[model samples]
Target chain A: MDSYQVGTNTPIKLKVGIETEAITMTYPFLYHSEDDDTPYSMISPFDPAQKPGWKQLDNGNKVNGKFFRVVSFLRFFNSFPDEETFNLAIQQVKDTYEASLKGGDVSPYMMAFELKSFYKDKTCVIESELLLT
Target chain B: MKKIVLLSVLWSSIVIAQSGTEPTAALQNIAPPSSPAFVLMDITPSNIIVPENIQAFSLQTISAFSGDSSNGLSNNNYAVEFQPYWYVKRERMDFFKYNNLTTQKADDSEVTPNDYTGYNIFGDVWKRFSVSMALMNGTFDVLPQAQSYVSVGARTRLLSFKTKSQINDIKSQYTAYTTFMSSPEVIAIFAKPGLSPSEINTAITNLETYKTIVTDFENTLQRKPVFALDVAAAYSHFMGDKNQDLDDAFGRFGVWASGDLAFYTPTIGTNSHVHIYGVFRYLRDGLNLNEASDLFIETKTDYGVKMELELDKLSFAYEYITRDADDNNEERSIGSIRYKINKSFTLNGGFGKNFKSDGEQVVLFGIQWGLDYEPSVVLGAGN
Candidate 1:
């Protein structure tokens, strides 16, 4: 196992790829950035990393990741077991985010995504996207 | 960016232009011959007098009818009308700022009354226009606030008689208006035990008088109509709340009466008519909130002219009102237009302005739909 320490000058890339099919993950979960030099709580979703690759466009189209920055990451048991359940969970998150967007101090740029090819014991990737209010 | 903006504007202009096609129906001579008449009803009040030909009880629906839309369609929002002889209505309607639809007036000092939710529950019975009775209990939020102040009000036609002429005009009528108001704090004190004998007696007397007025009004309807008169009374029942706001007590038992005279233009057929009226009211209010507990009395007069013109498919009304109330007097003018698309659908628009303030104006557009049930149609189907 390689133990790497991140610093303030170094940018972090949250790799969210599926090794298998039929897997769904909750996206835009609460994430706080941590570097080897900065305090763990120093980073917040309000002020995301303004790096270039943080807004990479794929396939000549703008993906959801381009508009938001990864705030925090957590791995847990799948809260949504099936496609229908995953849709329902994402809709609830969308509704909450839209409601908070009206008069919220922080930008409401939260989202969730799923991969059909991923399954079984694989950690569900939870990422919080930074919105440019 | 400039190309996009220009393109968007052009597209919008094109869309509007295309939507402005002339209506297929030809404009008929739909002007109503007379203005709309005001009728006080407990449930659904209709300015259009229902003829005796079709008096069968049917399922009735009333709605806020909107006027002509750019899309050539009418908008009707159905009102939740409860007309089960004795019922309650809770309505929340606001004044419309026509020119500046997006911006509200910056002057908070000039507040529009009747812009809050109202709850009214009343019991009424009528035998055509000959005899009618209503007893009402209602709460009104005169100011736009969280708590609603309450009032008790009643209205009755003491006597109404038709002249022997062919027009059968209403020769004379006597109406009595009574209202009693009190703050929640005063009401709380009355609710408590061990109140003074006089205080208790006053509350009981007020209730008894309310009952007497209603009963007497009903009883007098059997008599012939003579010189008509109007009696109005208002009072506040204060139950030993010395710390309450002074303005709250100003509403206490103010009583007044007036002589009312009305002249009507002959009915343009059976469905249309115009009425012109004037009223001189004398008011006396008890000002006990101050240390002096002085009685304040004054006379306020008002005059108004109303016209209701109704045709088979079109109807409209115009009103000019002037009132002298206390030191601050006000006059208002209002006009409304409604086009009945068919038997059950109508489009309406209204414009009103306060003559005292140039900037105070209101405009409204609405649509209405009515649904009635005919038992004969259903019962005769199998035959």
Candidate 2:
């Protein structure tokens, strides 16, 4: 992947519940990569279909808006059995994700994302990061 | 390992090849003609049938015809009487995945169990890990060597049908909870005392409507509520037949009732596959057959094994039938396995002999053709 050109050509997938609004889906590809040291392919909060403006780099040439990603931290967070237990679990995942970026593993290419769903008036906001290795 | 994989690939290719080709010419020759529609009850002649005939014949027939087997011979004596018997069985089981008790898709449709069209459309619910209601098919037959035969009886269940969209309402879906929570049964389980009658009536009404639609579609008569949302409603006076106008309503549908039938065939026939014990019935019937014989009990019995191979349906059954009276007991052993040629058709051949010393043993060869009815239960998903 290092040798391959990273541009708008990257393929990505969307994770959706059994039923969801089609238009608001977070799609693959529409993500912008944060760093070359990390992998791409992360779940992003911004719906790519809207084509949000990308952040400008110090050089400020618009960075061409190539890779954008989000990570599903659920794989790490759901292992805990309860909410009271999740505070530590969430910190652990965030710390692990941060360490991966510094270790040149996958964080350089990923970004954090959130999913908000309401059932029976119980609102749960799931915080997770998308990463590509 | 590679050869096994390659062989599997080759085998699959052969099966596909075979699946594509027309059945053997023998299939066409043995296939029963659709014209003699009443052939299911046509027990006048000794014959074997093929599966094609069984399928062609309607399931609505009340005939006592047995399906064909691969074996040619049958010593089943109960195939004579036309009386029908009833039986019931229960199978409730559970399902597990990765050892975690996770939420699963429940069969929440509100439909009756016997509605075939709905059954074919909705399929059985996999609620829990239970086969749910795997094989509750009812009724079977017995041999005539015994004066009295036995039949086990069981209850018939009705389904409460509800659509996927209905059962998975948006609120329930988003909540990751069961939409079927509204069911009368579930509501009762989690009911809070002091709820108003109107509030409770609404829930009971839902179950009532479900039962109405299901019975109209499957049964031949109306069924009063066996279980109701309101215990008061359930206990209220029985609602016997001022019943809703239904084309397919049943006479009556009760919960937890059972029935059985017993009869005998003067000569050997195919209904012998009905019971678990052969000698018990013979001894029981022998008491009736050898009455007024305290001094000298004269008796003759046949111990033989027969095979049936009419159609592809094969059976390897054994029978060591015996007859014992006040003074003497006679016994014999008979066993044979036969595979049917086509559906309902069998080519049976077997041998057996009396258990007595110097007993005459004879090889029996004959053809048995008849239809065997198989009942299947269709279930709905849980709420």
Candidate 3:
């Protein structure tokens, strides 16, 4: 909270503390455009997931839930011309994560995954990563 | 060009292991730090590269280290440096000719000479503090007199604060320093061609012909991350020459802040990469030329921005600058190319155009190199 000088007459000591969590997770997605003033696409956070193009991914492996879904089809759509590929990439990430947990047979597992979507011109890419512990 | 190249080859090889260090950005008397990636922006030298700003250089034997290696960290280190440079440039007016004039006349019809060639050679010895000697000489195409100067001075850091960010491994530091010089006002008068000698002397002199106390705060962020950022701020006060008339020595004060941001793209390979960088600088100057007035209320502010890109060892940079001055406003755009040979050497060339339709054009080329040696590291006596 306070800063002080360190010198021959004034000695100083420093300390740092860190807190770790049981579940370490991240969701990554972005809206990119060549013109910085405008976004490629945006969705209303208040809108319902049931809206057209908004669909949930299959959590057959029980690894995903409302709080930890790998794919939000609508959210990933329309942002890039390769919408289908983007959706597929998200689905593949979910499937791979579930398969890994099921195959590893660990209750509390450590896993990381990424979903990537690129612009039609390939000038830019929006990527997001998730880490599960 | 051939003669220059041969001389450089011979000079560089013979002085491969000079003991001194390159100049520090904190002091305007010395050349600014330049690199292929940050050439146009004129980046500041890091503290490690110019430790003279962190601590004073003193005789190591006098403060000799004990058997305990820890004691060595507090001892003085020494270094020697020698660098020579040549520059050619031209402007619409003989900026250096009427440098000492108190007032300027605005007459477009009265064309004046502007071509110039500058030569400089500097050497320094540093221990607890550092003392450097420099000789600067230059010629004007139309002016009958060529201004030149020989200067010697010493500087030391007065105070400092340093911290590190654990998450990003960013190191931030703030330093305050005072430098005193015995050189005549000639250096200031001739440093810039068109700049009035009075203005330069008033601005360059501290308590002495060249007395300056400066405070600099800087933060260097991670270079491997998505973006690398360096930011710094400085405030300087110059006291006029004591030998000159009180009014003639009217002092000046200045403040400057700058930032350099480099965005790194995903690595293409081990040795090759692409980076886009933007640099910005703002400077404020307050000057008083009247001996009767306590201080000149007249002030000027200047700002500039530079954008650069680097692909492997080749880089290009463009900069735009605007200065609000007393007589007239000045603006210019300059573009430069750099080829970095290694950490210690670089070749640079650049051209500048005045913002005016009929503004002057300038061309510049230079070679930069330096040598550094740490006694403890070189002798393997201490860490």
Please name the candidate that would achieve the greatest TM-score relative to the true structure: 3
The lDDT values for all models are 0.28, 0.25, 0.28
Q: Which lDDT tens digits does candidate 3 get at residues A38-102?
A: 22222221111111122211212222211121211111111111223233333433332321112
Task: Calculate DockQ per candidate and list them.
Answer: 0.00, 0.01, 0.01
lDDT of 2 at B126: 18
- Ranking the candidates on TM-score from highest down gives 3, 1, 2
Q: lDDT per residue, candidate 2, B202-292, as tens digits?
A: 3433465434532332221111111111000000011121222212111111111111111222134322222122112211111121233
Candidate 3 residue lDDT tens string, B93-177: 1112211111143432221121112111111111113333332222112112222222232332222222213111221110111
Error of 2 at B192 (Å): 47
Model 1 has a DockQ score of 0.00
| TM-score of model 1's chain A | 0.24
| Model 2: CAPRI class | incorrect
How far is each candidate from the true structure, as Cα RMSD in Å?
31.2, 25.4, 28.0
